[model samples]
Target: MGEKSEIRMTNDKKRIVIIGGGFAGVQCAGTLSRGLARDQAEVVLFNDENHLVFSPLLAEVVGSSLSPLDVVVPLRQLLPDVLCRTETVRTIDLAASEIEYESDDGEIQRLGYHHLVIACGSVTNLNVVPGMADHAFPLKTVGDAVALRSHIMAQMERAEVCPHPERRRWLLTFIVVGGGFSGAEAAGEINDLVRSSARYFKNFHREDVRVTLIHSREQILPEISPDLRDFAGKKMEKAGVSLVLNARVASATPEGVGLQGGQFIHGGTIVCTVGSAPSPVVGRLAAPTEKGRLLTEPDMRLRDSKNVWAIGDCALIVNAHDGQPSPTTGQFAERQGTQCAQNIIRVLQGQATRPFSFSKLGELCSIGGHSAVADLFGFHLSGFFAWFVWRGVYLFKLPSWAHRFQVGFDWAWLLLFPRDLAHVRARPTDRVSHAHYQPGDFIIRQNDPPLNFYVIEQGEVEVVRSSPRDQNGEVIAVLGPGSFFGEKALLSNEPRVASVRARTPVEVLVMGKNVFTQISSTLTPLRDALAQALNRRRVDVWKDEPQAYELLKRTPLKELMEPVPQPLLKPTAALAEVGHAFVEHGNEFFYVSSDGQTLDGVVTITDLLRARAAGAAAQTPTNQFMTANPVALAADDDCAVASNVIRECRLKALPVVERKDTRKLVGCIRVRRLLAYVFKHAVIGAPDSCQARNQLAGGAGRGMDWNNPAS
Candidate 1:
């Protein structure tokens, strides 16, 4: 309340706060400044950067056709009447009509406002496809453009120095994911730049360079008309850009991108122009959201909030003309900004605010080699004429006369001279990242150099080793969630001994060898956990007990498991009936089923005791006390696998099913029976082993027939 009072003051002036400095925020401030006098309101715009980026022309920056500074206008220069503050906003307190931000002086401050405009745009997120965040380049900001430009040039340099032909081709290849305006333009520009600059490098040839664009739709530029899309696609292909339509990226890695149907496109560089997520500030808002954008009223006001408005990429505003949500584009953002400002002024003057309504002006996309496509009003344009029109339209769209002139000059210079090839040589920093693999995808192959240590986050993977008996390779172990691998080779500084392949779609958090070593050496808890897992998973742990290992490996689970107890209880049976059955059969657990054969659930003695102690009625159904879909073994599984599963799960007994896909109950194997059978059959040379078998066998030695192990 005190903060509100201070912000309002005693004067008649009102304070309007704008949270972004993009096109929407700039347009809103411009409109508000003209509509209201100095005494009526004070307009303040907050942006982390002091400049507004002309995003549509960002591809030109990557192509080296436009100077980086030419596409950006200083906010202070653009909005002379509005107060522009370059500070990071920490949070927006909607209820208090205040915003908390960190000032340039490193102190937290809160400012109250009569009206707040949310224009903070969306951010690039590549996590939709696994390993994309780690391996793909994103083109969203000016910095991203610069970084990508540098990387492109760096790849060219590497390709020149490489002696191997295939390696050189890999270095020269570039893959762009997405078919939207950004993707099309970026791919075009990149192809043009690399092909044109090939002559500058001694060993570089235009034929060796490959630029591929992958899209999940049938055509490129789905926003434009079908004819225009076809024209653009054909024109780009003629200009040497390969189009991969109706293909979706399943995963991305340093090697390349893997498509959904197991096709891998090999390339050294991957540029992702898809996947946008809400900005942190916008995500923290309490308002309703669609997809990731805040849902606003037709007049651009935030739903349920009187003085708060939202526009641009962060907002989902329905258009009055089409009765459809407005597309997230610069033109729509500008229109929303202007309409929102007028509405705010109307609210201040006690007048009715009008709904936002506007028809789209046009769309222009520039492909490489002086070609473009345009959809203006109802007319379609393409080729060199469209390219010229595209340049002319964006030239005047520049906020400042100086920027327009600078960009115009750059375009003219590009037509007469070659594209720039020089780039910064700063080394990229390395960090831990995440990756995804599809079923049968080899995460690591045997004898391959260890580069990354992996921790399974989702799905399962199998440790496989090549054996003389099986040419396809024998599966040693199946690891699920919370299990980790690839550390043994990394820690020992040796090549991998066994290959790991995804048993299902898998996600893993990957750490580089250097990072894994540093953390494993310093973190005590992680070190101890890794050591314990290593001891349990060691491949040759039974080397000393050869005979015992041979017996466990050669025997099948069906031979070692006893028959399932007779008269399985129905799920409708009473808890009292289950207790009585357990006592009568002298079994520790009973299987529950609806039919006579199919297993539904298992009820242990512990479960019965728990249900009784919880004051459950004796008439309570057995299903209520049963553990459904319990861990089970397949009838064809070897005794060794069952032994490992039992030891890992710390279970006294495990149920055997007909197969993994079918739930038909076959039999059960007890730990005591398994250990006793192994000891009695295998010859024990060690004296301690004989004593251990005598203690384990106990009363079983009197009545049990050693010849029938499953009895």
Candidate 2:
């Protein structure tokens, strides 16, 4: 935005710029035009498409029961007194109170505002599930409805020609990845559309079509009560819609949807209404936000900036009545928008503005086959009656009379005729398939038949191979994004040599061995990249092998005999005897034991001082002053485990005993000697950090952190 010269207010009229034409922006603009005079303020509303989409009935458009034009209201006509601009936002400068936009004529223009209202609700977030942004159908706008409706028709047509039952089943399957209002209603409407239209095609049997709703939660329609959700679920099931509860999408592929528990839902079409992420502009702004929504004061003004106000889904406004963040819904947003206009006028007139406060009046959702669920006036209603109420409420809420008449006409016409079966061109899926794996999941197993070569798109993987000494898996190396693996097996025509496990939740592009081989045979760059990666991995595997002396690394402490004094004695010994015995035996500590082998406790200097300060009798036994069950290392455990215990406890030495037979005392290993052994053996083939010669060879020694687990 340009500074002073471009922002000079014409006629000294303050400009109120609204950035969205959605429910909140439209209502706010309408109320502003009526409350503030033309000379008092210039109201400008901006939308990329210059239309207010009636989002509630968007599913009807996809079902072909309503026309696309009926669901959107042109901003210019809806808010006649306000100036409407069809422009896409490029940048918003909150500090300067200016906005940069690309006009329809492809010109860069700047505008300054006195009060800025951000009502740009949200866009469909398909990024949560891998490949969904490219593969899954979204229903955020009228265009989405058109594309989806067309895709549904195309699938129907394609199924009619398909001879294979499995291919036809794939074509006929439609899965919605959410069980909320949008997803449930979309699935329900789709079921009606396909089944109702199936009778028209001789080859399109009603049984050929299938619609499934997948939700992560135990029940659907979280906004509604459990009873209502059950009511809705039962209705949907009876209407021939399948509900897959407690299943969340792990990823999406052209073939189907994969769930978190390794369950795959085969389908040709996948629709996602599950997640919504914040806009990039919201991230660019410097302000407080809750879950990506801008935090707003009770009066609807942005918390940090005085001149800025926000409403709708993008703004997390607190409801003064319940003191909770308001739910993102059409009715609530409209109320917020109306309250914002009043607040703006009050602020302009130098009066105290009121906080936004509204209790939800009602809720309504259509669940297909002329059935619906509604909670109005604190009373729940369902079946045909709720369906009728759903239609009436949305019809009355339509912004313009033109939309009202057109939508009412479509519904009236839909009752008498089957939805139009016009074939729509379906979008082509991406050639590369993507999937996500959770941490510890084996992306490829050792000795498993090679199926795919994976290119890491996100997160890291640990290349794990069996150690020669123990045959237990040891992590060899960590590979990150842009690294490709599985080429060795493809090149050698063998099963996988090493397993790849996710070090974190990972996203990867999977190419079949055939396609990978073909690419490697032709593309020099890809071939060179694979060759370099394979060579590094091959060397990594060789280095990963444990040396023969690595046996010492794994050998239990019980097997390493240390000729120390036999310190175990009766716990009932006198305090004088304990002190004299410790001096005579040349030991810093003494173990209290009832039997010759079982260690009951330890009497260190710290324990003795505390006991003496507490004024224990001079005749007290050593057991009375001892610290019991101090963290001890198991005798049968490896040296690595013993070293870790010694390091963590910050102890010079620790008692070791048989884990299976705790009565048997093996020996105690000193920290200094443990370090000497580790340095002598661990550094031979391990990473360079283990070069511990200086520390162990009589130099001043410090405690080893051993914090790096992989090392």
Candidate 3:
């Protein structure tokens, strides 16, 4: 108790870490901050990039309708209170309750957490096709947009200087792969840009620029109905985009793309819109997964680690309504973020958490200016109507009201000015040296002082416990590739409880836990929980297996120790507004208690003001000024129940009481504590606090705000 007291004194506020700065991750951070209104919790957002890109509007950037700045929000500005880190997540060590990633300076870090929100988002899948990496540009990010724009413009310049007609034609050719939204939109917009810009080109005619869209599948816009696909294809054909169906490029080179049907298309520019895979971090967890996405229950929680959560493109969320996984889209991602936030709150409040349901409101695709196709609840529409709807929906969906106005202005001004062509490029970093370790490799010895955690790219390991009871060790569990060990000891300064021996030749990601804490503090909650859980125990043992999970199962939830209890009314109860209570010691205001509980006071900013307005001196009794009833809660409750009490009562804070004595009010548990609970765990449950300290020290908590109550 004394140790915990000292720990609490040093660290008063709860910390929450969000891993991605994308739509889902950002929304989670923002919502937690706003919904909770206290300084007891902090929220942090983490990402590899310092800016938040509206990926859905990447086509606009390529089309010159929006500049990178207009579509991107600097992390520091939007989330001033929330910490932000730009780093690439390499792996998730579920067993040790931490995440490992590389920082901007190339230093590896490990983040410990109590909860985890796997919202790393998706990346363009470029490894599937041979030569794609060397020959094609993917329109998934700002860099891709800039590269395509520069290449297209450069081609135009070269066409004017080239004397040979064939060379100029090849220079003007543009090939797009996948024919999906990204491919189709880029093809259409580039075609429009070239056709519109050709009037100013000295030698190139509009006919010189040829745009071709290649699809391996039979249809385009697979999200839409078959009829709509045909309509979209016809529309593209009319707009001068050559549609190639039922075939894929066998290989791509700087010279051109070779199709499977023995046909080769020569083009100076190739924009590939191949499909995306779940973030590589998802692939690093040894949990049940579908394809590259982490497998989550209907409630968007990991199957084995119930307290851990996976959302957005990184997770395979099973829809309870239909028993199918939700589609990976911006809309669904937004919804999942919101739902996950709510569930996190619910779990903290000791309430029943709900499963995630895919609510299909509508789907829209923009072919070009005022040219679009949309399905709003199965009502298909095309052309201008769809365009308006698309514009309005996206405009409203922008993160902030400021963004909506900016987008509106951009739309209006695009008609007057040509698309900006200033190029923004991200230089590639030096390649990392490949390190190898075979199965049965002794990466590290058990009980050695803290060091780095490893990310497994391949193979497996055995987690063995060698206690004094037996000279020979017993294998506790088998950890396959993607599973991480040795983090707990590094994270909490505790001795390793078990030995990890590679079962097969394996690839491992290694990083210092402190560096991770510094870089990813805000982006991960599981680390926070792990740290908290570790602190709860006096004698800690770091094991290679799922010790954290097992410990969580064993620990009984208890009411937090606090001040004397006083019962008050639930916030939801109807009451008349009254004047403030008399000010007392230390700027405190007194208010009436519920059911004639004299000691129970609802002292707040409002109560103090009412007394001053009435010119009541300090000598006046606080009883008359106090509200007749104030909200109250039981101490022996889960976070979910506490949250519901606040929501139901419609109050800012509630005085908590022991389950045996509801009339007695203990130390107050405000909405902020609940928010902190959510923020720290990234989910809802008890956490290992020691791991969190290492995560924090290691820079794993780069983006978390420990003081932000909303988090």
Candidate 4:
């Protein structure tokens, strides 16, 4: 154990690296600094952020019960003796006992560590429900809490100005999508703030504001006893918070959250207090992981590596006391961090290490109104007593006296006065989210109520509609950048009639209906533009795609095959006439037919490029360069075969014939429109493999250059 001790002591000091600045990381580093001799060892803490976030109070910040400054302390000020770095860790080489990180200036720096402590906390994940990440507010950090509060206050201001009662109601609606500690507390706080602030606005009534607490389980706060959980739930419900129990969030949109049942909870603001995903740093490690969280031994060391240890939300630590995986809550993480630090010290000093053990500190959640439910010290407490204990416990746990005092002052001010009603400006990127989708992915589906109005920032999407009798849909129009859709349903208060599928890899901005209506109500030109677009809605195809929504099979070509306008040219026609055909009809390929019923050859713009390259004038005959017996799509063939034909033949448009015998052209399908047709018919419920096939077909069809064959 002492072999590398001398070498590890850089400049006669052993180096220990601790990552993250959360409860686990900060406490571990602080404990290590005190335990290790200053001259014999060095404790280095690396965090992308400069301050350690007092996470328990983050929800309070949103409710305006706590000040922003009260929930975070500077890492440098808290641990003056420890070396602190505000840099992002890039990679870790466990075998070499080294970590590589990038400085703020983008320069890379490497440091060797004799022992490493990984306590990087979790990040908010909304992947459980579609569009949840883009639509829901998170309470994981101070920034998140601040942004949420700003949004809440802004909604109130908007409601005061809005004349429409429906719009005002949407603005005032707040939905918290978790029933556990964060969810219950956040929902309760939001309820109190919105309800109390109504008197300040003449247009706003107390009944206009709505707050709902949704949980998938039968009860909220499983950590506490049923009596406490029931008491807390009843208290919040009595405070005008709607309880949605035993309902999982199937999806989330800007306008609302969709329950697994046929229920849509409309809300302007959605706060998701669930789904804490493992940190990206933890994912990059070479060790084994259980669902992105690094798995650690009973002693807190990694499953395979001895030098590296992991704790906090990013690690799946099993408590030695219970012989069960440790809870990801802050208290458990903090205890794990302290024990891990002591073990590291013992191992380095050539002493036996002990497995991590800890007793439950019990659980508590403040459910607004200066009331809380707690199971502290095996004593079941409710109402003011529980609330008092809750505040005292968190206040005592603050990183520094300065934070505790600031928080205490804020708490005292909150009890005496109403919540501060000022809107704190936050960066747009903090609350607004953007997403990218590959071609063939469904951006929106039909029959779903429109919660968000979308604007295409890049790439294109096809508006698809299907007939009531037909399973597959038809592409009505191709929308490009600056194009917007899904507004018609939101405005009309109706479900979406057609699906919006990505025609290419697309990036789009989405806003809740409250925001959309707020902006549209003020801007006449934008409202008029949206109105004009909605007026052009073709309702026939909006009936929803039955064949493509969820199936894993490839949508057959026969299903989408339709006769496209095939502009024809005689064998004697020249590239000059073909150019005229291009102007008259946008289709690049023209059938060189002696008889209009049968196709003799195919002529494309590429034929002109080859003809010109060979010194033939623009007046060159269509037969000279037109591809003979071009591979065509059989009307009965599947899309996968058609994909192969277009790919192998380097053809942009394929001829769909009545049969192989007569060679009679039914219609021509261009690669561009053909992919759109396939995506419309097949993408709704198609498997990933089917989507991949159609996407590949779409790619093959897009790169064809009729104007310049070489391109």
Candidate 5:
């Protein structure tokens, strides 16, 4: 009998989990798989969809120049050696180092991991204009492109046969909201399709069909120079697509769009191609955001949570050169993904991880046919030169040689064949109601066979463990929105640890076992993150201090109230001066603190109104009615505390003061100012706040807030 030599196991083998199959995720997985040796690591791609969508060519797909399948490569063939699974990851357990997902078969599963990579891309940002979700078409997913194509073809056909001229106009009119690269490209492509297709339809008048591009800004493709944007605008206008500038779509209906200028353009189909942000998952993480984008550190790591890393559209990684996060373009996203992969490897290998750096190599947009606009390495070109460069760059970036070959072949074949119009219907999984769930519903019964891990969508649920002496358990923990349950069972393939019942009508997603396992196996830190989240819920003592106002050092000034537009006085002694200031100047108040450093209380014209109402003299010190306390806060105090103090005292115009020696006021934040700040600046500025700085300073804390809309 001979003993077999012991097999050697090294740290070379690593498991990486990727959540999306978009350009970023696909590129990361493809690069990692091919770059590493067989024994080095394992790359597992977990996606809700089975194919990788070539996002840059999506407009072509919609234009009938290319088919949807032509742009989508099957994940299995794209990365042959890497593991590919179609599952919806529902929860990330960071503390326990695992992830949970719902498989197509409706079973919950979990996967443990050694490393994690989040390449989840952005989704279309709807819910902006009224009736947009119900009526507008978005061009993000493959299905969306196909549906828009079908709708366009069908509308052309319908317009030709219609007897009424108004109906025909409505049917032929196409309005695209936004003038960004996507919008301009989509408008141009659709215009080209209509120009070509109308030749075949007899009853439709090509002139009757109107194509309009509406933008809220003065220029399109802000990524390019103003001169280039003007050039693009001129090209679009020459092609018969009207450019509506400095106007936004206020609302959308099946019939048309209502512009901010009150101009109504009737249309059969409306397309929105505005840029997007991180997935809704970012919101749940409770971190700062920049315009709905998750803020990341210079190293492309999330602000607070370490051990966690986010890339692509999900992260607002600052550009070292411009002090701005890289744009959400396919090129930047792919670069970020690759950089993220490199960082991941370095982190796992105990090597120094490098921060993300951005270089503006190029920007391109296809106008129509072979005509395009491009800016490469500070070199700008148009027409054939730009188009050819666009093709070459994208071809080189394709995930695999097989995919590149397929795409190239398709491009060549398309010249000889008309585009195929076959529709592929991928049924949606209905494991959970996105909108509603009632109380007493057993989300997952204890002792029952565990199927799917539940991702809370809305409302609340209760995780109850039977008391040691009782046969049935009473309510124990109330899980609110964004909290997940059934994670243990999903990750370990083990029996249910507790009974989860809905405390209110709750909405949740059920993730199957295989998918959960796949996600867990790839994103190791997620397992620990999720467990820490649960533990945080369990140990939270905030509930005990419901009425307690915790003093925060960085109070958000935007959360405080601002004064309405009242007239400003010239600091005169006359009552007429103050009254005239309120009505004539319309400044709303005196700018007592124009300088950034030495600001005091502002005397608004509205104070006159209150004084008159109380039958008090306007000259009565002008300080008595100043509301002495005025809810003061330090300039560096937590912004959160400002809002709490305002709410608690029911006051407006909180003073942001310096507490060191002078205790002098710096600025007065009015309720209105606060509200506007929250509505506007919070979407952009908070991503660069102290909270983000503190979190990114150090620690394996979770990355960006997975649930914040700003993220």
Candidate 6:
């Protein structure tokens, strides 16, 4: 409505606007165009894509039996009399009888309609499982099918060149979650394609390729009879497909799927066809919804709205024939579309609308290798003959003869030749992404090439390094949310120094090497923070030494800290008073407080010099030059923690308090004194001094200057 163009009605004729181009929307538009005169109404259809994807054949696309375009029909060609629009519908205003859509150039446009049909089907949603959205392949769209096909070919290519047998086995494995029609068909096709194609590759063996289908139910194909379901399952297993029944998926990760009872299935490729949610536009409507689907009356009209109609997968419509909610399938949607059109015509003709009724035809599912199962009318069929019937029915179901002919030719060609193995080699682009890991999963291995920098978002990970004393790696640090890792190896352009494994189920924001380097180098604050963390982690080597670890743990801050050198001053004390006190006590800094007991602020010699350089008078309040709420340590903290804090904050010394809550001034720990203590007791003077002293003194000398005051 804001600066948007309004589509004016031609000759003041009625306009019918449909919001999707799926089976329902297309059939409704076609019926309306044929039933109404040109002068009576104008039919306008809106869809995000120009073509309608035949979802039933998507698995064949992934198996490379059909070209990606073979299963799609152009909407404009299918509905010549209807005005087809590819603009994305943004909002529906039922009160105004208008809908807003974004044009190709990103300009908003509005069109008023006498009638509105809601038919936008549901969308694929993988968020039901923890990591499924990030790691699994969805089979809901044409693009999804093509992307999965390319990934399958890429994995096979990688396996051919892999030197290790275990790694190659992982690469050749594929897992499909959900035992529905899509999942079962995909698993069957994947097994057939990989096994049949293995004969051509010199390094591949049929036995090494594994295709697993995981279903949570006792048997698959619940839409058909139990006999057909059993036949389909047995046929798939006989064709070399592993079926895991009665198992529920707890989460999905880069490694594989994790089951509810702590079973982890490891595979290289994972396909998910389980979850779905209503379209965003439909979900936003102000109407009663059941399980995210818009509720509609028996006549296919939206509840309490005469001019608005709802149909397809986005709507929950009760079928008069079955006395139950209609299933979300192509057959049901097409029938609903036809009946809804008749109801709309009846309303215009001043006649009462009829309730929608339809008897379901049948259910058919292909199990690859020229075998399928079918339940049609009262008859059930399976095996090669059933596969032929399934193909015959869907071939004629194509929108036009041209499409049917093309698909039929492709099917004939597939019978004579092997499936296509050629794929476009697209270079992967570096970007930031998210990843999930289950407990005990290795996120990164020691000595592996660093490819991603990780920032923890949830759960915890352990940084593990190999040790001479134990075969299992030692956990040097446990990192939780807000912590980051992998930057050390990336910044140094070397292999990982330590392996990172998930201590609990974890999620992390991962940035590729190039993206991480570019952002960190350009952002000064981020760069400085990473450098500080690197310096703090560099001292972890001392923790692995038994004597050094014991010494650090035994010594407390109260024992290592020196007494406060100068008397504390009030907050309102003059700068001249602070300078005189510093010179008298021969200290570089002094604390300032209102009562001299509670720690408030600190003023250093650097603060006084800067104030003087700025032409500040000696009468200026010291509070103006003091740092408020400075970093302080508790008296009970150990020397190891103190050393790490000093190195991280890059401070000469830090104030120590008796207790954090009391804020009573106790003493201060100096960097020089801590370093001397560590060298004398833990490294150079210790009984196990040779290795510890050489490693620390030699490797740490390049960055540390012992005599420098600020070190």
Candidate 2 on 560-657: residue-level lDDT in tens? 54543466757888777776776788777877778777767778767666777898876798878886544455566566445434433445677766
Q: Could you give candidate 1's per-residue lDDT for residues 1-711 as a string of tens digits?
A: 122222444347899999999989999999999999989999999999999999999898888888789888999899999999998677899998899887666667788888999999999999998879977999999999888999999899989988778869999999999999999999999999999999999887999999999999999999999999999999999989999999999998767899999899999899999999999998887889999999988888899989999999999999999999999999999999999999999998999999889899989999888999999988899999999999999998999899888889889988899988888776445468777776666788777788888988876676677644654675555565667888878877888877888765678898888888889999999899777665455434344455664577688888889988777889999998988898899988888779878878888899999999998899999899887655567688777666655554445778887865466899998877878777678544463654433322322122111111110
Model 6: per-residue lDDT, tens digit, 1-711?
244647777645789999999999988999999999989999999999998889999999999989989999999999999999987788888888889887777777888889999999999999999989988999999989999999999899988988768878988999999899899889988998899899988777999999999999999877789999999999999998999999988888877899999888888899998999989898778899999899998998999997999999999999999899999899999999999999998998889998889999899999988999999997999999999999999999999999899999999998999889997866556899888887777888777788889998876576666645544764444555677889888988888877888866788999999999999999998898798676656544443454554565568889889986568888888988888888788878888778877777788898899999999899999888887656567687676556544543456788887853445788898876766676676343344544443333323422221111110
Q: What are the RMSD figures for all models against the true structure?
A: 8.0, 14.8, 29.8, 14.6, 22.7, 9.4
Residue 152, candidate 5: alpha-carbon lDDT: 87
Candidates 2 and 3, the one with greater TM-score: 2
Compose the digit string of candidate 3's lDDT tens values, residues 1-711.
011110111144545557788777877777767665446556656798998888878888777777666678787777666767777777777786666776556666676655567788888886666657655788888878766777777777778788778878988898988877777788878888877777787888888889898988898888888877888888888888899998888866555788987788888788888867767666666788787888887788888775578788788898877887888887788888888877876765578889998768877888764578888898998877787888898898776778889989998887687665444443433232223443444555455455556655555454555555644554333444444556567666766666666554445566666654553366566465445423322222222213332332232223333443322322222223222112223323333454444334565556546766887665555555554334344455444334433432345555554442234554565544444443454532345444432221221322111111011
Q: Please list the C-alpha lDDT of all candidates, in the order they appear.
A: 0.83, 0.77, 0.64, 0.76, 0.65, 0.83
The per-residue C-alpha lDDT of model 6 at residue 97 equals: 84
How many residue pairs clash in model 2? 0
Task: Count clashing residue pairs per candidate.
Answer: 0, 0, 93, 9, 74, 0
State the lDDT of candidate 5 residue by residue for 1-711, as single tens digits.
222212232455776778778877877787778777767787888888889888888898888877677688889887798899887776666665466776556666677666666667777776777656656899898888888988888788778788768768888999998888878889988998887677677887668779999988888778787776777888788888998889988776556788886878778889998646567556555667887777777777767666566778777788777877687778888888788778777776688878888777878888775677888888888776777787778778776787678778876776676555443444334243232344554666566566676777755565555545644663334454555777656555667756777654456766666666667568978677666653433332222222211212223443352432333222333555556555666654553332333333356556667777888764654444432222255554444444433432334545555541232555556544444444443332334443332222211332212111010
Q: Kindly indicate the candidate among 3 and 6 with the higher lDDT.
A: 6
Candidate 6 C-alpha error for residue 300, in Å: 0.7
Runs in model 5 lying further than 4 Å from the true structure: 1-13, 35-40, 275-277, 286-288, 409-711
Q: lDDT, candidate 5, residue 670?
A: 55
Q: Write down the worst ten-residue block by lDDT for model 4.
A: 702-711
Q: How far out, in Å, is residue 78 in model 1?
A: 3.8
TM-score of each: 0.69, 0.62, 0.57, 0.66, 0.57, 0.76
